[model samples]
Every structure is written in structure tokens, then in C-alpha cells.
Target: MTVKVTARGAERWKQGHPWIYRSDVAEEPDKTPGIVQAFDRKGKFLGQALYSPKSEIRLRLLSRGNERIDDFWWSDRILVAARRRNGITATAWRVVHAEGDALPSLVIDKYGPFVVAQLLSAGLESVRRDVLEAIKYALEPEGILLRNDSAVRRHEGLASEVVLAHGQVPQVVEIVEDGVKYLAAPWSGQKTGAFLDQRENRNLIGHQTKTGGRALDLFTYHGSFALHLARNAKEVLAVDQSAEALARGAENAKLNGISNIKWMEANAFDLLRELERRREQFDTIVLDPPAFAKTKANLERAVAGYKEINLRAMKILAPGGMLFTSSCSYHVNRDVFNAMLADAARDSGRRIQFVAATGASSDHPELLNVPETGYLKGMLLRAIG
Candidate 1:
């Protein structure tokens, strides 16, 4: 292990920058990938690393302290972070959240007894052995799946592949969040079969779904919102573009022996407008769309999408109805999301009484400096026209 950081990179390290780019290096040739080492500009000790010359993130700073970046430290930190999460007993949750957990560009999602580990950077992928060993020892999950399917892999010059590392993952995973049971299909579904980050948001907004309320859920992927709300609401109308998604929503509803849910496959934008045109109204509306715009460059269009959906939701909202709107785009901050919601409220000619502002589950910790981890944002607002 040998390397040196750029002249002022040590300053960045001091300030808790979770990543070390290739430009940050000043010396030392790293022949092998995933090798942990320490270096400084003037031959002084800086910190240890999980090194990868192929990655833009060259080094995952394992420790700023003098401790080695070995199995003991990795296992300890991973468990410490995992223990902080609230409701991950026998279900899936983000056990290790990459940079937020100080293991840069690596995400470990525990799905039921199995775990899905994603190496989003070449540097972290370099330390596969240590990472896998840590999970095996600390978490002791049944199976470990390497879900390296993120777009970040392309940027790092790595190919996408999914493989079962040690054990086998079930096609279906049953998880209970806030007493709300969910059966997730990991094989042909969205990210590891569930949006675990929205667990807190889903549970929080359930209080608003009173009995006999007509609830409309747009982009209701897998019925997390629509199905859960049906427990209390009179009827739950879930809309999405994919028929497969709608079918799964229906299947999930049946799996829970639930009724009073309408799984509709349609463009949510057009459906919302149609509902407004027909003067149809819902007691509650939820907008949990996919990431419209991934990067900051397309933030304007993403904001437009949010504003449009939110505005339509407000239009069809019954008088004194609640609107639970959310955006998963990290580029769209809370301030911007709030601004978009306010604009939607004004467009609907309704006074927006904001009840609560919420974020992702506690398991997905948000580092103040790393804004990307603080992506999911939601607001519970009631419209009084």
C-alpha cells in the first residue's frame, strides 16, 4: 500500500469529504486494485484507503484515525450504522448506505434474510473481499446478491452484472414497516424489490388517510401507498404507466387479502387532468413519482414535472383534502420542492396548510455535507379552497 494525496486534499479530508478523486492523488503507484493504504504529499501519514485506479473515486477513506482499514474496522462500522436503523428486524433495509456511512460509493440493502450489496464506484468494488466478509460476519444475512446495476458503473468503466455471491435470495421478500406488511418481488421489480427509504414517509402519511376517504395514488409503484392507505381509506385508486406495476399492485393487495383498491394503468398526468375535468375529487392524493431528472442539469424539467403533477393533484383534491407529494431527485432540494408545492397550491386557487415535512427512513442517514444522500423529500399539505 503506497500513495500521496494532492497538496490541499488533506484539508478536504479534514472537512469530512467522503470521496477521494484521482486528481486528489500526488504520489505512489497502486498496482493492485482494492488495496488499502495511507499516504500524504510530504510523505506524512494521511489515511487508509480501498484503492482503485479505474475509479473516479480513487480511494474510499476507510479511516481518518490511525486504525487500519481491515476487516475489524469495516465490520464494526457497518454494524454500528445498521443498528441505528429502526424497523429492520426480519425484513429488508439499507444496512450500509455508502458515503453517508463512510464507506464511499457502496450501498448494502438487506432484503429479508438476503442482502443486496451495490458497489457504485471502482474503488469500493476493489475491496469486495473485505466488504463481503464484513457483511457475512457482522450482519450474517442468509444470502448476498451483488446488484451492480447502477448507471454509475458506466461512468467508472465497469460493466453491470447481478450475481448471488454466497447464499440465495428469495424471489419474494416480506417486510413489515410500521405494522404495514409488504411483499416485494426482487426479481422483476424495482431496486431490490422495495423503496425502503420511503418507509417513514409512508407510515407518517397514513394518519391522514382516515376512514371513508377517497385516496388517489399516482405512480403508485408496488402499491406501497395505495395498498397501505386502503387499510383506513374508503377506496384507494392507484395509477401508473406500466401494466406490470399495476398487476403487482393488485397482487400485493390480494396477498394482504385487501379490497377497495383500483389498480389503473394509465399516464398519471392525463388521468389527473381527466379527473379534474370530470369534476371528480379525492379526499387524499399522493404523488410518489420516480426520479424524473437524475442530474442537476435537468433539474428545471424535473421541477416542471413535480409542479405539473402537484398542480393537478391540487386541482382534483376535494375541499379540505390532504395532498401527500414527494420528489426523489436529489437535485431538487427541500426548498425547491416546497416552492414547487407552493406554486401548485397557488395554481389550484387553494390555500396550502402544510401539516408536515418529511424525508427518508432513519436507516438512510443523510450526511450534512453530502447532499446526494438527502434525496427523498415529502410534504403533507391540505388544500382549503
Candidate 2:
């Protein structure tokens, strides 16, 4: 099967864009869903892609040139990705980051001996067996679990299911990050069991805790950030609506033998507003909320939500306080996020200086050409009264 793409699509592909939307195809192929040879409108060979009939993204280009898309190709790609992460000492790290690793629409995160994989695209689903084989041969993980509960799978006409692809996975896997122990239920937990992307950010906060003062960690999932803050703060408040997550965070703190953290189960927005009204203050504040916008359509509303939380957070920070905030929405680029923070600071009447700006951990590498891979954007700021 050959996919004929429009001139615009051809230009985008030539510019290294991996997706060819349905509207971009000059003519759709009549064959079934599987691999197809992608060509320009002039019938020139452009690349090979996985054709997804039901998706808006009709073609997910796998190779840009004459490269073959065979079992060898899959094995080699998986091997290369595994080799790149050999330097990562942490047991829980992203082994393959979707397009960031040139394997678009597939994510693999390692949690100790067990590896959790997400097949988000129809293309990856078509080659599921081959992918599993490649992963087994390359990494030889003790267990391989498929976490296909992503909502995006609906667009691909695939049912969401979680199952053990290989070996057995414990009810909860224990992972150690920077000396902090965490219990992650990857099969049922959040994205890939934990926000492993925040590994480095948590370490940074742990180091910044040289001043033993009060700290507030809003939207603190599993209390990862709060535990780190507890290392330096005399008292740390970890807030999250999920009682389960707060319990797990409390358990992690107990595992580390740290008891300074106070777990609170309350909606972050409501709690922040209440704190602001009470004129409460904290020496450190961490805002690691979920993605406010998953798509461009929700960008405006997401901006407002981010601005609200950040504004309230800044207003509640004491003088010379440290604030670490992050946005995991790909639609919210660094420039837009920074601008939103600026607006929040201005509205809150807080003088702040961005001491550090960063993104995901090294294990989750960001490709310069593919900005979507750089989804996590963070800023460490100092509030000056």
C-alpha cells in the first residue's frame, strides 16, 4: 500500500514532522490498517508509516527514507533505546520516550525489574508482537506489563486494557529514587505508575531545603515532593484530593523514617483559596498540578487555571520563599507558561526571580525537533518581599 500525501504534508514530512493527518493525504489507501509506503503527491518515496484508518493522524511515519520496517528494524531500535539509558542508576526511569526515542506513539517506563509499556498508536498495536519480542530480547526485564488505559487508544479504535505481557508484576512495586522509597502500582497507578519525570526536580528541592522552615506541597502525588521538602523543612504540608495517594505518600515517608510531613486530603484549588484568605504563609511552595490542558483546544482555560493556582501560591509565600512550579501540558510551551507566571506574579503583587528553569529528567530526553517530547516545564523562583 502506498499513501499519497498532499504538498503540505510532503513539506511537513520533509521538515521531520512524524504525523500526516487525514486531511493531509492526497488520496487514502484502500488496504487494511498496517504498515504502508508513504509517498509525496508526485509519487516520490518519502518514507514508511503505520496507517491508522480511524485516527485523525492517518499516518505515523516510522522511517523517513528507504529504511525497512521489519523485525530487525524493531529489535535494533529497541536495543538502541535501551543502550541510551544504561547510565541511569535509578530503577524507575523512562526507557523509551515515544517520539523522543524515534519510536513514536509508544512509551516504556522501567520500575525496578518490571517494565510498564504503553502502546498509544495503532501503528504500534499492529506490530505489538514484534515490539514485545524486541523488548524482551533487548532489555530482558523481569516482567513486561502493558498499560493501555490511555484515552488516546479510543481514537485508534483499540480497547483500553491492562495486562501482564510477560512474567508477573507485584501488586505494588517498590522503587528507590535518590534514597527515597516509593510504592508504585504501575498496573493501576497514575501515568506509568509514577511521575518519574519529576525525579530530578524532587532532588533539587531536597537540596534546597537547607533552611528548615515551613513548606507547602500542593497537588503532591504520592508525596514525592513533600518528602523531599521534609528533608529540609521543619514542617511540610502535603495536599492532594486523592486519599489513596496521600496514604501512599505517608507510607513512603514512614518508609524513609521521616515524620515531619502533614498529609492533607483536600482539593488544591479550594485549599489554596482558603489559605490565601487566612493569610497563611510558607517558606517553600511546590505546585505540581496535573496538565491543565491536554490539547490546544483547552489552552485558554488551562492558562486561566494555571494563573489562578500560581497567583494564589505566590500570594501565600513568605518573603525570601522558594517556589517550584511545573506544567506538564505540551500545549503550554515554556514561553507561554513563563508569560502566565509573570501575569500571576503581577496580579499577586509579588516580586519574584526565576533562579532555575528546567524540564524532564535526563532519562526522558527531549528532542529539539519534536517539542512535544519536552512536555514538562519547571521554574524555581525566589519570592522577594
Assess every candidate by TM-score: 0.94, 0.96
lDDT tens readout by residue for model 2, 1-385: 8889999888877787788899998887774678889888778998888888889989887887777677778879878888888877777998888888888888988898888999998877988888888888777889999999999999999899998999987779988888888788887888878899999999987777647799999999899899889988999999999998898999999989999999999999999999999999999999999999988999999999999999999999999998999999999999999999999999999899889998999878897876768899999998988
Clashes of 2: 0
Give me the candidate number with maximum TM-score. 2
How accurate locally is residue 85 in candidate 1, as Cα lDDT from 0 to 100? 78
lDDT of 1: 0.81
> What lDDT would each prediction earn against the true structure?
0.81, 0.89
Best by lDDT: 2
- Residues 130-159, candidate 1: write the lDDT tens digits: 888998999898888887887788877778
